[model samples]
Target chain A: MGGPRRLLLISNSTLHGGGYLGHCQQHIQKFLGQNVKRVLFIPYALHDRDAYARTARAKFESLGYGLDSIHEFCDPVEAVRKSEAIFIGGGNTFRLLKALYDNSLIHEIRKRVLEDGIPYMGSSAGTNVATISINTTNDMPIVYPPSLKALGLVPFNINPHYLDPDIKRTHMGETREERIRQYHEEPNTPPVLGLREGTMLLVEGDKATLQGVTGARLFLRGKKPTEHEPGTDFSFLLNDSNASNL
Target chain B: MGGPRRLLLISNSTLHGGGYLGHCQQHIQKFLGQNVKRVLFIPYALHDRDAYARTARAKFESLGYGLDSIHEFCDPVEAVRKSEAIFIGGGNTFRLLKALYDNSLIHEIRKRVLEDGIPYMGSSAGTNVATISINTTNDMPIVYPPSLKALGLVPFNINPHYLDPDIKRTHMGETREERIRQYHEEPNTPPVLGLREGTMLLVEGDKATLQGVTGARLFLRGKKPTEHEPGTDFSFLLNDSNASNL
Candidate 1:
């Protein structure tokens, strides 16, 4: 299942003082490389597909690749099957997942990315769907999906745009760390990777490396959360057995 | 089915510079009155039921009421059937709703509160469950519940501890207002009330009043969100017909 998988799971598209994908432009260019001429964009996370596609197209074109949205195609499955690369942008996680199931593109997209060895990129909501489940997402349940289960491209779950708690503020809502701890309280749950904004996890073949400016925090069940800096190899997370004890 | 419905739905338990239930103590005592002696506590939203129960018991006791957690009882449904009043504190909405279904207390509690007229007090996650659904909650989906359909004690949904977006921050996450808008995009959804901290809605048989230090915002499907003051009459929301147009 892990064979030929290529993914660049980004925490967010826009960082502070930056435009869309401005923070990670160089990384996106390198991941797609010189061979891929065009990319298929999935903009179902948001309500306005036409506008979302236009934004994504403009961004991808500036990165030296042609981009077409799946919503524009008559057959989304066929579009996914023939796509050189797939990029799912950020928005509402539940809406994005519901659309994926509703469009029947889950299996098709998964097959193309995992088996066919296509380059895959995701930010925020997109990064959430690339993991085992959307249970760890920060988005509101604006809509209910058929299931929490996602693409399972990664063995673990992800919390994108993860924010550290401001101890100075007395807001009683559960902190991002506390929410991840709650997820671990459930039975047989996997480790949760909290990818801070401006950070990403790049996976190629069987290797996963943390990339970008900031670091990420990994939470294992019944253990203190550990922080990993940029350039740390997270390939151990790719193995299901390594996540068993976690 | 509105019958003898009585409820006090609070946004959050603790506010800045306040202890647990500190800001809304007077309203709690007034809502329960001199007739009710004991309050049944539901601590299911948290991982440590005993700890949650202890904190709640201390608060209720200080308000001159006896508090016993449902977990201490062998039959939770029977406990709800015989309780004088109910108080559900704040935590994770998903975990709390799952426990309500798991313990088979949904039907029993609804009967006691709506028909029997036992005063019902809910804060945060509790307020979320008292509404039509938990679709507007700020909590993560730590666990999957059987359904999003909650107690439906109120005709509208609630977004508790609702915070206004800070224009100063460049975080890409959806603002609280935007999340509720996305919820309306779904068909047949109810109106959403965004309750700021230190605020609550007090509902009697035929009347509902917004009472607290701050105010609330009401969002209709296609209309602009309107702000309401503390003393605004929200009893219109109790009527199903009023919500239909909203």
Candidate 2:
């Protein structure tokens, strides 16, 4: 848990206003600091990769930084190695993981973020791949990846855009909390962070805080879900102490 | 598509009015016909196997049929082979398939329904396992099975409790339609039947019909989603004529 890892894992890019990356620009800047000049953008999750990159380029340019899509470069590995910061946009988690595997960049990106201390930021399916596995993602299994294993960027898995159990809805499908509960029941599964819309986790050298306007729900295997408000530090999720008990 | 295959695939076990298997019982009875004496129930989908069987027992008893839980039998294969009808209740799809694999019943159950002309009925996760693959299910991947392949009782996949896209909601998650679209993008994927709640499909020999009050959304790869009314015969879905194009 103790490292010089800088990460801004956002739940969603858009809030209720439908602004593109409108709410998390400040947090992104705060995590990246002033040294990172350009950001490497991975838009492999969605089918509309070009449109996604254009939207992200506009937002990053507005924040006084340059952004380049990995697909634009002939040598994708060198492109990632040369970047100061990395940003991954949201779409289908399976596609994103498959693309990452297809490009053979899983280890390269992991080294850049965890070893070199490069700033890392992602939203939705992007945030999903940063965790131990994409088992907790809300997206469909659009494509079958080589494995469900993901880069070990974080100790716990993240359930992005997590909707709490709706008490009033007549839908027979299992709710988000119940789904995460089932996930926890699996052997050796980590705690799941249910990050709601407009919320994110900002990780610095040794600690991380749940930032933004909304609260998140946490699911530990056997215990009732505990709610954490914005600004709550979740550095414990990076440690394996509680996960062993489960 | 022609065979002596009798099946009733339901979207949900309960309806908005909170009736316990109320909406689909008539369809089930008609599919099973008047000669079935005992039915075998699969309760491996969720943790509440006992409670699920108890509820299903009361419902089936009222319809002049005897229901027994397969878990209670000493030999699960013998139970499935001897049963007059088969019912699978809904819960987690991954767990259900995992359980089926763990019990080594996939081939046994497939033989019972596909070759023996047994009456098969399932709801939600139950219906999901009847498709060629469980790739299009809305449930989370809580656990990984040996394979994503399902019972192959049907020619096409089914998405139970399919929710329509809400125009006014501000949620950023992928709508039901978009998820299915992504599924279709994968190679060799079959057409997906988006079965809305309170609706079901009745299969007799080579003919299959969408029955009940609500209609279903049909998604074929690279085409606009088409809606099918109740009583619409879905015989085409049982053949690979359109699947070869995908």
DockQ of 1: 0.75
Off by over 4 Å in 1: A1-3, B1-3
Point to the candidate with the largest lDDT: 1
For model 2, the superposed segments whose C-alpha errors exceed 4 Å read A1-3, B1-3
lDDT, candidate 2, residue A176? Answer: 91
Worst 10 residues of 2 chain B by lDDT: B237-246
Taking the candidates in order, what DockQ does each have?
Answer: 0.75, 0.66
The TM-score, computed over Cα atoms with residue i paired to residue i, of candidate 1 is 0.97
Give per-residue CA lDDT, model 2, range A155-198, as digits (tens). 88899998876677787777898889888767777889999999
Indicate which candidate wins on TM-score. 1
- For candidate 2, the docking band is medium
- Going through the candidates in the order shown, the clash numbers are 0, 0
Model 2: C-alpha RMSD to truth? 2.3
Top model by DockQ, which number? Answer: 1
